[model samples]
Target chain A: MVRVTGVADETPTVRTIRFEDPGMAAALPGQFAMVWVPGGGELPMSVMAGDPGGAAFTVRRHGPASTALYGVDRGDLIGVRGPYGNTFDVREGRLLLAGGGTGMVPMMRLAMRVADPSRVVILMGARTAPEVIFERAAAALGEVVISTDDGSRGEEGTAVDAARRLLGSGRFSAAYVCGPEPMMAGIVAEARSRGVFVQASIERPMKCGVGICGSCCMGDRLVCSDGTVFDGDRLAATGEFGAIYRDKAGIARRY
Target chain B: MGLATRVAGIDLAGPAMLASGILGISMDVFRRLLDSGAGAVVSKSLSAEPREGYPNPTMAEAAGGWLNAVGLSNPGAPNFANMMRGAPGVPVVVSLVGSDPDEFVSMARLFEGLEVPAFELNLSCPHVEKVGLEVGDDPELVSRIVRSLKGAGVRVIAKVGLGSSDYLGTVRAAEDAGADAVTAINTVRAMSIDVHSGRPVLSNGFGGLSGPPIRPIAVRCVREITSRHEIPVIGCGGVSCWEDAAEFLLAGASAVQVGTAAGGNPGIFAEINSGISSYMERRGYSEISEVRRAA
Candidate 1:
């Protein structure tokens, strides 16, 4: 069980809930944990930055599960069951990280792991200025570029648009993206054309955050087991990557 | 010396199948499951057309089991058949779910030229409407659907679960309709509510309960089926360990399907198979049939 140490409202709908979890802090970036609220429900939450003293999760209010997760009081107990799925594999090359909305949660963790900030470029986007998350935190790690759909923040337009511009600069070896499927699909196409590898953390309805429930699958791959983090080639290979995904009912829904 | 077993004329490398709905979709995943030590792999229940199951909150933890309402999601039978065209020499049992006899027959017919070893008629999905338990509960519908599939010359295994009707009656209907075998106990109808929000935890509001909590009931169902009927029974429910597999076998299940257990580790198949092998050796049994025969 992890104790809530702090909760910071990152945006109107998103909040960063901090906890004291020594074990979770050791989990690699891009992995997630299954948090169980006593009466709410167990759901997968991406693990954010953590230290030996504390760990955190960036949760966006979406449903009862998230609401229950967000309703925690400081010091309330939450059951955690992972650090599941593959983590971002850092390599010896310039890195480009692109994220949008709550998708930026894992990206923030990735940004912190890079030893050389000069080799990193962070592209973030949201619907409006207030919705933008982890701007300062991301900026502290690397060069942060912000975009909002309403033109209320730096460079109006989708984050993929700014990512395309960054890719055109021709300085990165790979790109890591987490966001809406359509936006990630766009960024993946742009990155692939630029001869850069891309790793995307795709979200699916997860049951057993460990990989058994088969709830989190993209065609043949279980997002929880095979990955919530998929490489560009893997993303391209899965027919459902940007096209469709299975919901809680195991029915395919268009992205 | 060999862990191989046959159920309703379908050969399996082991007695454990990658249960329907978990990593049962792709040809690559099927191959991987087979390689990971599954005797056979059942596909996600395929419908006539693509279905976009319930919105988020599809699964939840309920004590010792999982409650899920993944509304029989699949890319339609025609699309899945195309995927099966690339089958990699593994024993693949295609699971088909539909509301009508024609829907089930048409879906089964699509695999006429494919390498599908058998078709498991999904007549027992508890949470979905129209299809699953709804269709399964109707004896006439179950019989007609099974008869039609049998007439198609497709080997059929009827998957049954506890619903409003007597689940055994559904099994009997399938057997009378010429179903080659029976898989006992799909997830039992169940639900969970978020006390804090005062709302159903699952977006679908209801789902099938699976995992360890359902294991004893599954074993009882398998035992009951074996006791009353002379058909091959595949036991499924909360089978997470080797002991559960052994218990199911002692209760008369010819084979068992692992679902929720695989959620935590796909490698559970390998582990279960390994554990079963060790048990058999220690007990001086060479064939799984020996345990079944003794039971």
Candidate 2:
């Protein structure tokens, strides 16, 4: 059992919890871990920090596990297994990281790894101002840009729209995006059109983080093992990501 | 040793195999099963065309186990054939589902010159649209599909569901249609409502139920099918432990398929296999075949 050592409300619906597991805190940024809330269920969450002994996860209260997680105290015990999947490569160049909703978790970690602060840009979006998380934290990392659907704060329109405006004026070597499926899909498309190397983080309901359950399979790729981070070109090839996912019976449905 | 169990000349290390539907879809996961001691790994059901499957909330837990409507989402036979090429040394069983006989024949032919160990005709997927056992329920259709794959040279196992009005009749139909064996008890059609929103748990409204809840029904169906037919019966449904597997064997199943139980515990195959070996050892039985119909 891992002990929770820190908790911060990133948004009304999302919170970043830091664990006191020495092994987890040392996990790399792009890798994710599975948090089991005992009776609730096990869920895969990306590492929001590069510290192995002090791992963190930004969770949105959307399901049972997350809901129960929100009730956890700083000293509460939670089960964690991993540092699984691949991480973002923060090589030298003009890097642009776009995050929307809860997708901002990993991007915040990526922002810290930018070798050159001036070359890094973090673009974020949300439905409203209250939903925006880690604005100050992200600004401390690099140039932070925020967008909201309701124009409650920052620029009006979606995160991709804001990214387009940023791209119009600057030349970026690579782009990393994470958000809802549609948001990531749109960002990946726009980034590809601009000839930027794009790696996007994907989410799926996963049971076994080791790729045995097959619940998180996206086309030829297994999201848990092959990726939660895939380049634009690779993401476009998997027919399931932007499209529909089927049930056990062969019916076309959404994720 | 009573009788050696061999399907199409392929020696099964044991009589228990991890069925196709449950986490058997991914090559990595399939490898894990082999590492965990599954005699064979059945691939997830594949179709003639690629499918996206159903939406969110496709699986839900019930009183005894899980219900899922994962809509046989696959990468299509063409792509699946390529994936199968990289599989481990264990026998690989390819499961195929289709709406009509032509579709089944088309999928089977795709693997025709390939090295697949066996083919399981999935006539019993409960979540698809007008395909699977929904159409397989027609005895004539089952006959036609099986007949079309007669000389495929690969061992053919006709996988069917329970709760059908004419369960024995359907098994006979598949045998008459040229099935080399049969896998009993796919998921049972079930549904659940979200008490708060008053909505169905699955996007498909209803899903096939598996786990301990369906074990008795599976045993009953296997008994009926194996007693009446000359073909080997592969008992499936809610097999969680060696005792459950042993019960199916006593009921006359030559082999058994582990599904929902595997999802909860990946090491279950090894545990069950070990348990069976120990039970057989104590009883002075040297082979798994000796336990079949031991009752």
TM-score of chain B of each: 0.97, 0.94
Badly placed stretches (over 4 Å) of model 2 are: A1-132, A135-213, A217-255, B1-4, B7-10, B86-90
lDDT per residue, candidate 1, A165-218, as tens digits?
Answer: 989999889999999889999999899888898899888777657665566668
Per-residue lDDT tens digits of candidate 2, residues B1-295?
4323675455666667888777755565576677777877788888887776764445666767787887777778877776666553435788988877777777877775566777888888877767776766777888887877775555678888854557677788888877888899899888987554356756678888888999999999988877778888889989999999899999988888898777636788888888888888889998787888476
lDDT per residue as tens, model 1, B134-157: 888998999998888888888999
Query: Which ten-residue region of model 2 chain A has the weakest summed lDDT?
Result: A244-253
Runs of candidate 1 exceeding 4 Å displacement: A1-28, A33-45, A49-84, A90-96, A113-121, A125-133, A145-175, A180-199, A205-215, A231-255, B86-91
> Whose TM-score is greatest here?
1
TM-score of 1: 0.80
Candidate 2 Cα deviation (angstroms), residue A224: 6.4
Best by lDDT: 1
Q: Give model 2 RMSD, 1 decimal.
A: 9.5
For candidate 2, lDDT tens digit of each residue in A80-182?
7677887876656788899988788888878876745688899988999999988887877888888999999999999979988777665788889888888
Q: Residue A147, candidate 1: how far off, in angstroms?
A: 6.9
The CA lDDT at A88 in model 2 is: 78
